[model samples]
Target chain A: MTPSTDSPPRIYTAALAIIGNEILSGRTQDANLNHLAKTLNGWGVEMREARVVPDIESEIVAAINALRARYDYVFTTGGIGPTHDDITADSIAKAFGLPLVEHPAAIALLEHYYPPGELTVVRRRMARVPEGADLIENPISKAPGFKIENVFVLAGVPSIMRAQLQGARAFIAGGRSVLSRTVSVLVGESKIAELLETAQGQFPDVDMGSYPFFKRNALGTALVLRGREEARLEAAYDVLVGALSAAGIEGHPGELPD
Target chain B: MTPSTDSPPRIYTAALAIIGNEILSGRTQDANLNHLAKTLNGWGVEMREARVVPDIESEIVAAINALRARYDYVFTTGGIGPTHDDITADSIAKAFGLPLVEHPAAIALLEHYYPPGELTVVRRRMARVPEGADLIENPISKAPGFKIENVFVLAGVPSIMRAQLQGARAFIAGGRSVLSRTVSVLVGESKIAELLETAQGQFPDVDMGSYPFFKRNALGTALVLRGREEARLEAAYDVLVGALSAAGIEGHPGELPD
Candidate 1:
């Protein structure tokens, strides 16, 4: 949906495809999704969906195709290393039905970074890119991430992936950033579910969520209101606060004190 | 994939469907997927895939149907609360072509938990369940989660979801647990990519992953070996250790000290 602004803020949705067996196998915790979600949100682009697929070529291709078609941009993390399990690059190429080629720039960068004789055949595999793709510079590692059309292939490592994302910012055209406010109530969600529903119904455009928490032998719910319009958010917050007061509950702004 | 055992170990697969907008909007970090994956692994069941959909009914139904058909079991977290946004039960019922009915057991539990006159119309909504579904006990809260066929609908809150999972374990018929060993090394993945590949090839049953990390101004990779057979895992570990030694890299068991 378009936001009311001088430029009718275009809604851009992006999907993330995480490629690795480690993540799926519960061996490694994926640190990329949260970081990428926060980063994209800051840039006014919504990270709509995320899929974690194994290193299988068919799975990667399917995930890439589905996400890229639905969202404005599709970012893939992992499977781009020089190891045998590193199949993301080829899988992405296969998704687009394009030939995987060794880009001259990528090869030169790898050559410049590593000593002449040190650049082995396995290391050179990192230079392979899909045909007609642009390089997303990885300053930390010389082996650059590539962008083929709407798909961006990033490194699996968190630090390298984040570094590549910095360069990726230039390519994305974001819109109005979503803003939010939280109010914590010392009551159960069921006790205030009707109140929240009423508030939500009143502010049709804003999204209100009630998250219950248990702390220090006390139960409470954190009511969060999120939307693009700050004025509307403030209005909705006031309504929620008023509703809680009427229900004999004290509403605290932001998170409840630990 | 069948593992080599006295009687081939049955590989039971599961999928998790996270139903919430907070996760997709970056407002909440999903604590369910990791916990569920780890728990399933312990039960000798593999968590094959995970999908996070919004509060939308159609999305929930689609995810539920797809995951349930593909995997042996499907666990859905979030959207079971007594709020307007909590439409998981209805969506699940719609998916299975079952009528949404008020379960007698769920109503009794809620009635016993809440004081007289406290159980309002909104609070009573929690009693609704799919026809012929078994109630999942919630120790922390009175409102019970329900298991419809292969899908176990649990609360979104971490503590409650975990509590419900304890009860769900009784319903699942788990297979042989998968085992793993992590070998940390003081060399880049590219430096030992071929070595790891060779080790992986040697132990065909063991799945090996090389995850590179940068710590204390040094880059290294963590080689994780996983298999159903403990003997196979041990054999793969020795092979990986030998490979690292051959490449003049020191390999350490478990994770590298920070």
Candidate 2:
């Protein structure tokens, strides 16, 4: 991708819909959202929002519809297994008004994985995909995830989800990547709230955030600036560092607040 | 909380809005949602949904309004700090049409925590609360969280958040708590997909879920049944186990899917 010199760089935003009763019920702590967010960031895509919904079909349908409409890409994790409760593929089909068809490629993969006599009805469920969807290759498991429209359906297991994401990333079109810088202030965030707000106003395009952290007996804040333009981000970082020095607070580079 | 005998016992639902750029940026993994969900479940409240939004005011306002309107109770974490980026309190006030005021109790707590010369302008920011809101005590830190209408605003720090939650729990009136039982079958979830669906159909009121897991190169599924009625939940669990046994798969109790 060529870097654009347009006044405002192109911005690509994505959203995640985590579908699982296991997550909502607190039985399983979700590890996919963070992984996806970091991965997407590296690929020049911003994950703007994320929602964790139950395994219910209607809930999954609603979230997919809303997110796919609002964001450039919508990636859904969980609820794609071969169980009665695994309803993500069917829900995505319903959301897009497509038929749930058994994909030939997926069936072939499953057929090859399981013995000729072992391809039961339950195993066949894994081969079903939304009509006209492209298969997302899964190296760890033979059952493939599929992408329909702008929604990518991946397995819930962390390992499978990461692998599926790597495959899906190759097909995605990314915009200008976001550049970030974190400056750790040796004082509580409250002490520098006003200065941070002033700096944010000066750099309206850059998203500035102050996170307070406490570790051992020390308290500090990490001032993070994120923007699509590297030059603008560095300028904003300079402004933040200068403001901290003016307030008689020492700012350290690359030192994250606990 | 009373155990009710009424068929299809009352179910209380809640939604959480996690407000912070740290979480969205993947700089911080939110620890509040799972803790709150587990805690609320013990209080007979089911946390149905959760949304993670950035520190932007408009996003926070929109999420708070939507969640508060849909669920029985709405709990928000993060962004209620003493920083310029800590806009959760103001955004929440805007959402409910409440005036931002210096809460007397909050101010007193700050005053008591800081010495005569230590209460700076930034520190006093924590004293602001929505008008007519009741203070949710913060035992770890002096600054207090508050409750306005159906929404509860807590400190973003995990320790302070947990303490504030403990104080706020007493004011909530709980309905019938959900009873859950998990049966682990030493077979793939797809192997028994049809049976699970049929059992789910039989117990329509119970929230049935099947989670697939992989451990030590072995794959299995956990069948979970949740409902407000213990007898009904037990009945559903029995049905699931019986179905597994009929399918020649042994169902183990309390054995979690990996």
Candidate 3:
């Protein structure tokens, strides 16, 4: 075999579509976006963006279509239940220009879980998926979520969404995992803004951010460094810490408690 | 003056753009979206959509432009601090094709807040805003947020953002407030899905949603009815409760505890 030259690592990106009126209406605080972001980051997939849209069909279709075309993966949560407002399946089908059909496997799963003849018409609505879609197992509830192309439709409930995401892991082809390190100091962010800007200029490849926090009646800042390369991140962190030391501020290794 | 006809009330809509890499990176769970949504709802401005974008200027500009054009008002939280990562003001300027300029009022506020000679060049960045923008006062910190056209820019910190939003309230023109009523029943959503659908069909003006919950080792569903008219929402709620009673299910007045 011939030796191949090294090339840059590919990046995998994902976007989330939170489909629910409860979230947009402030009736429910979405707990899924953060979980999905951290989980995808651990799997080496960067969560680039997220949209919280109401339960309306046109809105869901627009968000799904836009996100799916722009990223490697698109995950949708909410509006997959058996209620009348559960229109995500129909919206996804419309977005893909596909037909909505009842998946036999999903029907079978519901059949096995519920008592005989207990799956009413409304309950059977959970078995519907877009044509040419595959099922993403939901261990929490017998009714399964479906995957159509790059979009994975999961239950709105956090626990079921997390479990179905595990079922989705095998399908995702992750790239290089982005590593992050945080340095904290008991000083306002303005005090270290100049130093961070200089360090950021020095390490152009590393992404740096300064987040301020107020704890115990004192203000502090947490400086985070993120990159695909560990050594580069460490070098930037060392430079930042050295600069803080020169400025007579003690930089800690991790963030302070909120 | 001539008497006016009893026409339908207008609906005021708004969108939010969350500008921060920390939010997309899952390092911080966003505490502003819920508060903003709830506050806007109480002000009779419906929060129709929200987008969470990273600190990239192009992304921020794109989200702001899209949201500002589509909604009556647009609000953004984050990236407006004294740090180098604070690029929201510049991004908003670019979004509007307006020149970024240091506002004299903002500079005065910062100058008065900080001690003499304590407002460094980096801290002075907080005074920079797009040309032809009004300042939104931040009571917690003197660094003011800005309102450019239909867009209101606020701080990323929850406390500061909340205070700034209050300052922006005077500029808002609110429509009729949306009123909501919830009824809870100890049954899976599927059990009442058909009845809820029937109720929704009867009262087309009222928006209905069913949210499933699991508490104390039992399953329940909360059916929420929302509309601009109080009497219409109450009528829908009563019909839904009557349906549940007819089915021999005792429906509670409000949602179950999570």
TM-score of each: 0.95, 0.94, 0.97
Residues A1-258, candidate 2: write the lDDT tens digits. Answer: 324345565678899999887787778899888999889989888888999998888998999998999999999999888877788989999999998999999888888888788888888888899889999997666667889888899999898899898889777988767778999877887788889889999998888888777765788888888887787888899998998898899998975634
Cα error, residue B212 of model 3, in Å, equals 0.3
Q: All models: lDDT? A: 0.86, 0.85, 0.91
In the range B177-247, model 1's lDDT, one tens digit per residue, is 88989988888889888988889889988888889888778888888888888877898898789878877
TM-score of 2: 0.94
Task: Report the C-alpha lDDT of model 1 over A1-258, residue by residue, as the tens digit.
Answer: 335445645788888888888877777777888888889989998877787787789989988898888999999999888999899989999999999999889989988988879989999899998999999987665657889999989998888899999978888898878898999988888888988999999998788988888876799888989888888888999999999999898998998866
Tell me which of candidates 2 and 3 scores higher on DockQ. Answer: 3
- Stretches of candidate 3 off by over 4 Å are A1-6, B1-5
Model 2 CA deviation exceeding 4 Å by range:
A1-5, A256-258, B1-7, B256-258
Q: Model 3, residue B132: displacement in angstroms? A: 0.5
Q: Report model 3's TM-score to 2 decimal places.
A: 0.97
TM-score of chain A of each: 0.95, 0.95, 0.96
| Clash pairs for candidate 2 | none
Q: lDDT tens string, model 3, A118-224?
A: 98888889999999999997665565788999999999989889999988887899988899999999999999999899999999989999999988789999999
On a 0 to 100 scale, what is the lDDT of residue A243 in model 1? 92
